[model samples]
Target: MTEGIRSGTAVGSFWAEEERCGGRAVALPSWLLTTSNEEVAATVARLYGGQSRSRDRQQDLFELTLDNDAIAVNVDGPEAVVNRLVLQQVEEHAPIHVCDGFNFLQPMDNAGDPCGCPESVFDRKAAARSGRGPKPDARLAFRLAAAPDLVIFHLTSSTWEFSDSLSAAVAGMERGDNGAQMTISLQRKAVTTRSGMAVSYVRPILSVIQQEFAAPGQLRLAA
Candidate 1:
C-alpha cells in the first residue's frame, strides 16, 4: 500500500496554510487587520486588544480594529521579506509572468524561453502602470513584538513605492543581527499628476527600529 510513498518519491506537501491579513475584503482601504480566519482574529485580539466586527463582502469577514496605524514587528532576517514583479490575469491565481525587473524568472513564451522585460526599474513601473507589464508582488513575514513567541503573521502588497524601496530596506536589515526589530505601518499620500488630477492612496511602510549588538565584554572576549 505504501510502495509509491517512499521518502524521496513522496509527492505530497506538508506546508501549513498561512494566515493572512489585509484590506482587500473591505469596501474602503484602511490600516485595520481584516481577515476571515478565526485564528488570525484571536491572535490580533491577544496582541492588540481590539474588538472585531463582522464585515460582509461576498461572505462574512472580521475586521480587527486597532487604534494605531503602525505595529511593532520582529523579523527573523532579511529573508523574511521579498518583492517581485508579476503579471497575472486574476488576483487569486498564480501569475503568468514573474520577473525581478532585470530578468524573467519564469518563461513567458510558448517555446519555454524567457521573454524580454524592461531593463530599468522606471520603465518596468511605467509598463506595469500602463497594463503592459508585470506589477510588484511584495510579501513580508514577521511576528508581533508584543507576542514574539506567538504565531507569525504575513502581509502582502502590490504597491510600487513599497517595491521601489525594498532594496534599501533589505540592505538596512542585512546590517542588523538576527531577530531585528522593525515597525510596519500604513502611510497615506496625495499627489497631483501632470494633467492636474489629484490622487490619494495608502502604501505600506517598514522601518527599522533598533539593531541588536553584542556586549562590550563579549566583543572583547571574541576579539
Candidate 2:
C-alpha cells in the first residue's frame, strides 16, 4: 500500500524563548525544540527520548528540552536555507520591504525599482537596529542525522550573526556535489561594551561536518 499522506513535513522548530525576569524578558540558557504536530512529537520522543511537556493551554505545543549544546543535522542543499532582510511596521504580519542586504529581493512598491537600502551589511544592520530599515530573517530546514527518515526539523532566527554567516556557509556547502552533514550548536560568548558593562549571550551556530566534492572526471559519491 502507498504511504500515508503528509500535509506539513516540518516537524518542529529549535529556538530559544525568553522568560520574564525583573520586569524584562531574558533569554534562556538552553534551546527548546517545540512542535504542534502529534507525529512530530512522537518522532522527537523516539529519537531524543527526552521528557516532553505541553507548553500551551491548548496542549498543542509540545516542547522537548535540548540540554546538550549541539545536535547533528543533515542539510539537503543550500536551497534548504533562506536568509534575508525584512522591514515591517508595528503589528504588521507582512514586511513592507525585503532584501539581501545588497539588493532588493522584494521591491518597495513591487515596481521593480531599487529599494535604496544600504549596500554594506554593517550599515544595513544599523538601519534595522535603529528601526529605519530591514532586520535579518533567516530559516533553515534539515533532518536529524540520528533519524534521517523521521522528519524535517526547522530553525528560524532573526539574529544578525546568523544572517551574516549565511552567505559564507552556503558557499562552502555549494562546493560539494550533494547534501551536507553539519552540527547545529548553541555558542555562548561574553563581551564588554564600550561603557564597561559586560554582557553575555548564546547564539545558534551551523558548522558543516563534511563536504564531499567531485574529483576530476567523476561524480561525487554520497557518504
Candidate 3:
C-alpha cells in the first residue's frame, strides 16, 4: 500500500486546501546579507541534516530532502534577501517514480492490481523527460503534518536553526551592504493549481518567525 493518507491504495489525490499567509519584507543586519549561496546552503544542511540533492545556479534554488521523506526544503538565494524558504511534504510514489515522457497520473499507482501503464511506474529518465507528465494533483499542496518528530524537529527546530543561520549570515556581511531584502513564506501550492490552507496550521509557524526575529524589531510579520 502507498503511504500517507492511503488506506488501501486505490490511487486517489491527497486533497488539501492551499492556504497563503501574507509575507512581509524584513531587514537583516547587512552583515548576514552578504553570505554566498554556498555558505547559506551549508548552514541550512547542517542544521536540518537533510541530504542535498540539487542546486540550480540560474534559479538560485537549493533542494534537500530529509532521510525519512518527512519534508523537503527549497532555499532560493543570491537575490537581495534569500527569496523564499519553501517546505514541501513528501508523499509516497510521487513524481520520482514516473517514467520520463509519460503523462503524470493522479496517484501513479494501482488499487489492487498494477495499472500495467508505463506512467504508473518508473521507466527510463529520458522517457519521462520527453513530454509533460500528468497534470498536477489538485488535492496536493505543501503543508505541515503532525507526525512523531515532524512538528518538533522539522517545523520548530528547523525553523529555529534557519533563523539563527540568517542572523549569523547578517553578522558576517560587510558594513553597509544594505540592498537585498529576504522573506520566508510558508505556502501551499496545488499540483496543478492553487489550493486552500487552514489558518490554524499557519498561525504557529508565523508565530515562531515573529518570536525569533521580530521581537528585536529586526523583522516584521505581514500576516
lDDT to native, each model: 0.57, 0.66, 0.25
- Superposed Cα deviation of residue 38, candidate 3 (Å): 1.0
Count backbone clashes in candidate 1: 0
Report the number of clashing residue pairs per model: 0, 0, 25
Off by over 4 Å in 2: 1-8, 17-26, 42-54, 107-113, 175-177, 194-197, 213-223
Each candidate's TM vs. the true structure?
0.67, 0.77, 0.21
Error of 3 at 147 (Å): 24
Best by lDDT: 2
Tens-digit per-residue lDDT, 27-118, candidate 2: 55777788878777777667666566546555768887765778887777655677777787655556788766655776555534567888
lDDT (10s digit) by residue, model 1, range 44-65: 6776566654665635466665
TM-score of 3: 0.21
Candidate achieving higher lDDT, 1 or 2: 2
- Candidate 2 has its poorest 10 consecutive residues by lDDT at 214-223
- Residue-level lDDT tens digits of model 3 in 1-223: 1111111211111111212233222321111111124554454455435455444343554444432222322111111122111222233323433211223222445223332334432352223244332212111111122221211111221122343444344332223322222223343223432455432321111111111121111111110
TM-score, cand. 2 vs. native: 0.77
